[model samples]
Target: MSNLVEVKNLCVDYITFDGPIRAVTDVNFNIKKGEILGLAGESGCGKSTIAFSLMRLHRPPALISEGKIEFEGKNVLEMSDSELRKYRWQGASMVFQSAMNCLNPVKTIEYQFWDVFDAHDMVSNREESIKKAKELLRIVDIPEDRLFDYPHQFSGGMRQRVVIAMALALKPKLLIMDEPTTALDVVVQREILQKVYQLKEQFGFSILFITHDLSLMVEFCDRIGIMYSGQLVELAPAKEILQSPYHPYSDGLGNSFPTLIGDLQEMRGIPGTPLDLSKVPPGCRFAPRCHLAKETCHIKPPHIHQQNECRLVACHYPINTSDNRDQLPIKLTQVAEV
Candidate 1:
């Protein structure tokens, strides 16, 4: 598949009286056509910042200080307001965190859909807009008759489905879902994700699935990128990441989730808090918490390097290598108690 979106040397900073806080630093990754790429990281680790920056939705307090965001060959950072407005829902759409509550309380479901269609000039009249809305509702398994009901009338799950339907109304090439199912219950989350997977299969639109749920990402995404302290520490196929995580942070994150089938491994929380962005460590941000950290690790940051044909990691002492695979489990166990 061809690359659908490319984020190169992306950096986002928050302007504050104290100083600029670097939220994202030199982040680089790409999403392919018709593929789902998951961005997994803890809150405040810059996952959401990257998602918002991709569509130029980030505002003044947050600025794209340095980077290039390219969607299907056009530079997103350079687009005019008019071009961006046209590109937004038509070329890309975002299903934000807490998206269920994003529905306007005053508008009926049908009217909201009409607003989307009208904004993009997709339909000429209310009748046509309603027709499109009904079709979209049907796609998400929502009853078409509910279109006239107000936002308060639908259940939380139903409201979320409505948002997903609206996002797809424009048939965008890229869909950015930032914790799309975070607010839903487990059953609802599964149902919604299943529906999303089916829709992706049908529409062939690529997805950037952002969430802190590594296990869920492992199950749903084709490839996964693990972010830490505003940098992508690891990137690989989901199965590969699950089987042999290279970065210590990635390994710790995987262990944090329960596994039903594997040997019962202790859930290990990554030690220490996330880096303070305002005064980020000089070398490796994770070295302070890494069990394998050496003097070199604390003095020199490691650049992202190809681990093999299918994986990449940014760690001087990566785990699961032929030389160190034997000691990985022991080191992980020791780190778990920290």
Candidate 2:
């Protein structure tokens, strides 16, 4: 399948008073037509940064220093603002983090919903706009009556449903969701995700789902990309990654999450903070905490190793099937068969 969106050699640098802080490195990935690719890692892993960069939403402090963001065979970075406006929602739309709070408190949900249509010149008649807004609310499983209510009047989950409805108003080909359901309770989150899953099937839209919850990503994503510091350390099919992670950082993340059906225990989060972008160390940024770090890891970051048809890992030691069984770390062994 051809890629719906292709990002190549992407890098983002944040200019501060002290110096430039690199938030994203030479990252390259693609979203195939109708594929849902999950970007999983901790908060500071630059998942959201990449999402923002794609929309050219980065502010003055942050800038896309190098890369090509291609959408439908065109370079997005070179597009003019007027040209970009045409693609912003009709071609691609983003459901942001804590998007519930992104709604305008003063405006009624219906007004907010219609504004999106008006911005895109999709609706001209006020009555027709209201009718469309009601339809969108129903699409997201929200009550039609809530359309007249202000954003502040609804609960967080309810407001989130409104935002999602707004995003779907255009039926964009690509939907970028950055923790779309993170603010809701588990039951609500599941319900919203199920709706999103249904929407994808119904609309035939591709998604770039970004989240730190590996378990959630595993359950929802077709493929998963593991990011450490600013780089994509691993990318693989969800099941393959869970069962046989090759990168040390990826292995550590897999081990941190408890099994959903077996144990039902609290997840042990990854230890230690990520490397400082301004003062990034030489070689691999994850070298300090990686258990498999070696002399080679100290000098340079390893090239991504394509182990099989689906798995890719950037590691000096891509753990083979048989490698010093006794010397292998406990966490690595446990997740190797997950």
Candidate 3:
């Protein structure tokens, strides 16, 4: 499949009183058309930073220090204001992490849905807007008449569904969802995600789902990218990641989640805290916490290299219990030939 979006050497920094703090560094990935890509990592690991950057939604303090966000061969970073406005909802739309709070408490759902239609000039007639709004509500399994109700009148899960409907209003080619299932129960989360998957099939839009929930990502997404301390440590198929994680951080994340089919076992978390972005070390970002780290890992940064045809890892020594563990630093060429 062709790529819907491609992000190259993306770096995002936050300007502070002291200096620039690296929130995201040298991140590169692409979302295939009609594919579901999930970004998983601990909090403050720049998962959301990448998401916001994709839509050019980063604010003043957060700057896109270095990067190229290309969608359909067009550079988003260099787009004009008029072009950006048209590109946002029509090309890509986002369902923010705080979906419930995104809605205005005082505004009726109909008016809120109309806002997107008006902003994008998608619908001029009120009757058309209402018709579209009702169709969206019905698609999300909500009663069409409920669009007239205030946000406060609906439950959190219903509000989230509303947000999802709003995001799909313009039939964006890519939908970036940042923790849309957060603060909701498991049942609700499953329902919302299942609905999203169904919609993706119906609308044929690619998805960039951001969340810390690795287990959830494994089940929902086609590919999973694991980030640590603002850098992508591993990118592979979701099941491949779940079955055999190459990077240490990815392994730690895999162990952190409970498995449904397994016996009850203690969850193991990575040993140390994440690196301080302000005083980032010279080498691998996860070296400070990685159990498999050697002297070379802490002294020099590891470049992203492919292990197999489909897997990419950024680690001098990827986690391996087999004979490869004693092979010192792995050579990418040899691994790719395996």
Candidate 4:
């Protein structure tokens, strides 16, 4: 399938009082038409920053210093204000993290649904818009009668469903969901995602799914990309990433989530905080915490190697997995690759 969105060498930076802090560095990836691609990493990993750049929504202090975010080969960063209005909803729509919080408390759900159409200049008249709103609510499995209630009247899950329904009203080509289920309870999260998965299958929309939940991503995403220190360190099929992660950061993440049927185990976190972008070193950013650090790792960053179809990794010592036993900061750089 052809690429629906392509981000090449994308870098986002923030000018702090201290200096320029690089948040995303040399990021590159593409989402194909009708595919679900997951961006998996811990918090503060620039996953959200990439989403903002794609929509050209970064505020002051945060800037897309370089690189291109191309939506169907058109540069998003170069779009005009009017162009952006058309770009946002018609081309790519986002279901943001805690999106329900952005809902207007006083506005009835029905009124808010019309606003989305109004912003895009879609519906022709009030009656037509309300009819459309009712249809959308039904599509999201929300009751049409609940449309007259205020946002505050709905539960978190219902509010989230409303937001997602609004995003789908325009039938956007690419849907960017940043931790879409973060606030919902586990069962609700599953229900909402199951609905989303079903909708994607029916409507044929590509999705950029971002979350720290690796296991969920594995189940939902056809392909997965692992981000580390603002860079995409690995991109592979979901099963490949889970079974044979390459980058040390990706490997560490795999270790953090245990299987459901396995012995009940305590979940562990990756040791060492991500690098401070302002003071980022010249060499591999993960070397400080990597167990397989070598003279080469400290001297320069590694290039991505395409080991197989849809499997690419940036790591100097990806094959070594010997140090898995090291506690807390488990360094698997020495462990033999299975």
Task: Provide the lowest-lDDT 10-residue window in model 4.
Answer: 329-338
- Per-model TM-score on C-alpha atoms: 0.96, 0.93, 0.94, 0.92
| Model 3 misplaced stretches (Cα beyond 4 Å) | 321-338
Q: Sort all candidates by lDDT, best to worst.
A: 1, 3, 4, 2
Candidate closest to the true structure, highest TM-score = 1
RMSD of each: 3.4, 2.6, 4.6, 4.0
User: Given candidate 1, what's the lDDT at residue 195?
Assistant: 95
TM-score of 1: 0.96
TM-score attained by model 4: 0.92
Instruction: For each candidate in the order shown, give its overall lDDT on alpha carbons.
Output: 0.88, 0.82, 0.88, 0.84
Over 4 Å off, model 4: 263-268, 320-338
Give the C-alpha lDDT of model 4.
Answer: 0.84
Q: Where in model 2 is the C-alpha error above 4 Å?
A: 263-269, 320-328, 331-338
Distance from true position, residue 110, model 4, in Å? 1.2
Descending-TM-score candidate ranking: 1, 3, 2, 4
- lDDT-better candidate, 1 vs 4: 1
Q: Which of the two candidates, 2 or 3, achieves a greater TM-score against the reference? A: 3
154-174 per-residue lDDT for model 2 (tens digits): 887787778888888888999
TM-score of candidate 3 on Cα atoms, chains taken together? 0.94
Clash pairs, model 1 backbone: none
